[model samples]
Target: MSRNGQAFERYQKINDLFNRRKGEMAVVTTEEILQKFEISERQWRTDKQKLEELGAKFEYDGRLRGWRYIEPFNFSDNIPLTLEDMYNLRLAVATLAQLNHIADFKDLPQTVNKIRKAVGRWVDHEAQHKAIYFDPLPQYEGSRHLPFFLDAIEKEQQVQFDYFSFQAHQPQNYRFDPYFLRQHHQRWYVGGWSHDPNEGFIRTFPLERIEGEPIRTGKYIDFACKPKGFNPITYWQHVIGINRPARGLVEAVVLRFNRVQGKYFESQPFFQPYTILERTEDKLVVQMDLMIEIELIRKIASYGHEVLVLAPATLVEVMRSFFAKAAEQYTPR
Candidate 1:
């Protein structure tokens, strides 16, 4: 290992020691550290000094006979990164650069350039080689409003905008208390509490459907109206995709996929609450606890003949109807 690699390894070891002692009254003595690393006392002192320089503060406890952190710190934040770490970061920056075409990520290319310059000193010229490439994402509208919605959510403010739903002949004005922004299937959707007369519940609005920029209402969020203990992060825990049906209840959705398609589900699951009930040479049966929603239907239909809905009579009937309609489109007239 190089000098930088050795330094990173030693810092990682020290970090592990501190993490093990976290939330406990126990302390790790300098002798113990030195013995573990097989380093001299002088070298250990130097290491401690370097760590302190990197925002880690430690003091020797006379009564405890060991060193204790004076403040919360993460050694990795300031320590030299290994070559592999630098390479991986470079790859990530490259990947981020590909998203520059998106309005919300327009600054990514500049940020990637900044990172390349910062790491130029440690990395070789070969780092500039485009060794990996990502498929270009299709340009989708409505990403430009991401920053505005993010700001509104952060400030706990209400916003007003004009939205044109597919069913509506004209755009309709709406007042909403922005809660969170979610990206699904390359499109952006903002989930929030709607203040419209007919829709007074939490709902999501697709950004592309929004006619123009949303203006802040100059009013703070109505905390009283928000459901108690409702977390935006876990709001869709039982639902698939972004939409949560108005009266949908969580159900056990069982599916059987052919061996080939089963491998795909096994390697890359689509839902969080996923479990494999049975596996055979010809088929794979999996169950997911989720709400019956449009996204779930779309996902199941996407697998076509490769997958079969095995449980939840309602879902099975829904799938049958969906396939029947789809098959009718291809039927000879």
Candidate 2:
């Protein structure tokens, strides 16, 4: 094989070894790589150098005697797409196609076309003949304001918008210091510091509830004047979904799932800090460290009898009460 072909083959082998133990701290050791590929120490060092040149970062642990990725890195970014890669890109482009109708993503169709043109040759026409389907995008209001809010957040400016919340009797004008724009469950929300005396703290507002265009104030956000210990990036990390509780602490919420649900949860976890405590033939017990919030409770309720809360007496009672009220709705009058 040519030098470039040999290097690509080595890159593929290295990626496979790292991925086999995904999420583990220690990946393959230098000795293991040399033995597996039947290469010398010099060749291994040269391979590492080539990978680093392509933006892959690695750190060596003396105690573990293995290398760990400093950051999540993938060889796919630097390598040419394989047949499988082209198929995956097609699926991704199909998903992005759904966003083309949205005003905020108006340029997506053009971008998608560009991608399709670039990979058109590699795509499998026979596979394209097979009917692959995707659910139509749901019509969501206030998406047009996404760019407006995004610009304000980038500029660190204050904004004012008339909001009509479900709990309110009338629309209220709110002055906010735009900090972050987040999307949850297909709805856009702007999270920032509110100027209202009743809500003089960091909060999130649904863009769908905004009545009109948001007016951006010329004044810039004074980060020094922000509430103590506020970080836009880490604000919602400890919680599932949105709406961080005003006075909530992170708790280890334990749950037991039925065999069927356990398989699903194991494959696709609901949130981060997901760890399996115990596993049996019939049930799987898992733990997630999160702040108890309405969204968390709602998520648990969505699973119905498939899941059971095992720890934190407070969450157990909340789930019980939530089910009771839900059951009451179905009772005969």
Candidate 3:
């Protein structure tokens, strides 16, 4: 009754009724609605008309055994935000209004309106918020797997897929007990346990290599469920890639990031799981004790003198052999 708008009292009653019924058909009994709002049955009709004007359709469905929201409702449009919420909304938009999505947030006009209303900011006539892109669209079919895999995580289920590991270069059957989904370097990946836990006696399957029809094996294994104990940051900690054994020999991987590159990395890189043990006089040191990726050698090669692969003789030799070939091509008379 003390809520902030003319229709606020009605708003609370309808939202409460829908929630109380736990998302079933939301039809409220007319008598209960009147008692809840402390209004007469005639006044209830007036309020219902007001709700209908705001894009809510409430129909009496005898079959549903209660009132239903019909098909859709636009709660964001009808509920106005407080002024404080406006600035908060702007900050959130500034931080996250990037990255391309399939359905196109551009087409989510309702979402746009909600943001505009929530911020109470200028919706038009000039520069407001715009989408930015740094990463290109993933050129494969599983680019859209982020959302679907997220659902599988919430449902605590297993999934089957036709997978292609970059190492293997061909697709194979994979049943994964998904642990978590993570983002690193603009790529989406599902991290999980598999009933086929050992790929070749020690490694696990990578989900990106997974392709084609993903069978939704919703049957959950309570004992094998891993999300409860899996900490993504520490799990990937000191981990070079998915193929490495979870527990093996830890190495001190040393590399430098100059002032500019250090900040660039801080802004973007998913560096967790890799412990940074030192910062030297002229550079920042990143150390991760994980299996060496032959590709990581090339990444260090591109950094040139800016990064040094100090210690770990095995990795240094690997980098040496790779760059030695490049140095051969640069011989000049």
Measured by TM-score, how close is model 1 to the native structure?
Answer: 0.78
Tens digit of lDDT per residue, candidate 1, span 1-333? 878678768977887787667543678898899899999999888888888778887777788789877666777566555578787887887778767899878778788888777778544664555577777788888988989999998989999999999999999999899888998877889998888879778899999999977899876557787767879888888987888977658899999999999999989889876888999999999999899998899999999999999999999999999999999999999
Best by TM-score: 1
Model 3 per-residue lDDT tens digits across residues 83-168: 66665665565434444354423454556556656555544521555443344555444455666677887888778888776667
Residue pairs that clash (backbone atoms under 3 angstroms), model 3 = 26-67, 27-67, 162-211, 163-210, 164-209, 237-273, 238-273, 251-289
Least lDDT summed over 10 consecutive residues: which range in candidate 3? 198-207
Instruction: Assess the local accuracy of residue 311 in candidate 1 as a C-alpha lDDT between 0 and 100.
Output: 91
Query: Of the pair 1 and 2, which is ahead by TM-score?
Result: 1
TM-score, predicted candidate 2 vs. hidden true structure: 0.73
Candidate ranking (TM-score, best to worst): 1, 2, 3
lDDT of each: 0.85, 0.85, 0.62
lDDT of 2 by residue, 144-239 (tens): 889898888888888899999999999999988988888888888999888888867788998899997789886765666577888878898888
Pull out the clashing pairs in model 2.
none
